[model samples]
Target: MNDVQIRTFQVPGARLHYEVRGTGPLLLMIPGAPADAGALAGLAACLSDRYTVVTYDQRGLSRSVLTEPPADQDVAVFSDDAHRLLAALGDEPAYVLGNSGGALTALDLAARHPERVRALVVHEPPLPELLPDRERWRAVFQDVYDTYRDQGAGMAMGRFIATVEGDGAAPPAMPDPSQMPPEALEMMGRIQGNLDHFLAHVLLPVLRFEPDIAALRSGPVPVTVGVGAASGDGVPALSARVLAERLGVEPLVFPGDHQGLATDAATGAEIIHKTLA
Candidate 1:
């Protein structure tokens, strides 16, 4: 069933562009910064056979336009956006999977509205604040922000990438553009355009976010922290381990590294199926 419907919904300060596919219990997949809904399209399609998959461009990204001028983004608002999206889409709690910074949003969401989440799977959330040398990470993030301001998105991103380079083999290379679908190409272009806003406004604020540990640890929501099998010693994986320890659960191992969800959807879908089961 390849039927997919695109829709829009107006939130407080933004209008969200979201897509719905398949038929089953609701499954919301949240993408990280600079990635809109399309980043997870493959994974969503793979899981659609057993899920009513929902994916959306977050505020100020791609088709999700900000009603007001762009500014530093807030985790609280992002969580609220997810809450509103879920409330609008269905009456029942939904299963959620968030990747990278998206995982941070999911963590905040579960902590803020535990009743709205049936279960949550956070894949390598980059919670620098949770690390042992948080101050150093904080300084690095600050430098990234400053670099974005003084230089540009490219330089800032280079610094950011250096900090999170995993011990694993590199992620899969992008397919040839000529061989790519038009929609996929469009999504890539849109994501590229979002780099400026993401680096200047979203990066530092998100990195500075501290999840409410007490709420997540004691809340009703079942939180599953996961790490890529190959993302050894990376900041994201380290943070995932720390978060899992705090939540009192071992981190679930998933295939590939941080970008696995986007690059290896079939395997990711299968693993997620087994996990949710």
Candidate 2:
């Protein structure tokens, strides 16, 4: 990614760290959960040969620093940041790929500004509000925050991961939180810092948000909602299917689980390229 350039975008009280690469049409990739722009580096490099892949740290996370006390975590603000980035990068009607929470942001962006989006590819967005059993998932999500408040970050995160992943799977591959391995301990510290923001500012609001189906239905931008092949029973995969159905289309199956964009970049990028093509 020698051609990749990193820059900052200034919003009201925050500064965003974003990277741009490749030479073709702009193709923005939005990350989800606690992931920063770095999470998308492998995938960005994978797609840079075909499109100018853009990724960034969302505000109040990683390098996107906020200048004031934490405030809005509404999807609209995230969508606005994306809108500004596209205009600043000299691309209008750009192609977009959003994974997880980022996918939700892309949906908001496309819905509010159709003229700025060429086509949208959303993979495994965790939109509980769209699901038939939304209340169940909502309770589970809140339980994560309660875990943090009572038990601690590690337990909170482990539960959160398993809750979304479903099937009683997640978190064992990394060094056990109780073991305190250097990398694992360090990662846990970061998670502790981000967990509060994610729970109070980001995840809660996003969980409660209701997408405007009427707006999305009448919108002109083409959208391809996809679910991870491995996340069949997970909340995010089910949410993707529900969202696709709401939009009068089927959710395409992609390579891995909810975090596939970061973990399976190569295969995920290829699948995205085909969908966008």
Please give the distance, in angstroms, between residue 39's alpha carbon in candidate 2 and its true position after superposition.
Answer: 1.5
How do the residues 38-142 of candidate 1 rate in per-residue lDDT, one tens digit apiece?
989999999998999999999999999999988889788898999999999978999999999899889999999988899999999999998999998899889
Clashes of 2: 0
Record all residue pairs in model 2 with backbone atoms less than 3 Å apart, i.e. clashing: none
lDDT of each: 0.88, 0.82
lDDT of 2 by residue, 115-207 (tens): 889999998888888888888888988898788789876687787778667765654355456766564455445545676688667877877
Number of clashing residue pairs in every model?
0, 0
Tell me the spans in candidate 2 whose CA falls farther than 4 Å from its real position: 170-172, 175-193
lDDT of 1 at 136: 86
Clashing pairs in 1: none
Model 1 lDDT at residue 277: 73
Which parts of model 1 are misplaced by more than 4 Å? 167-176
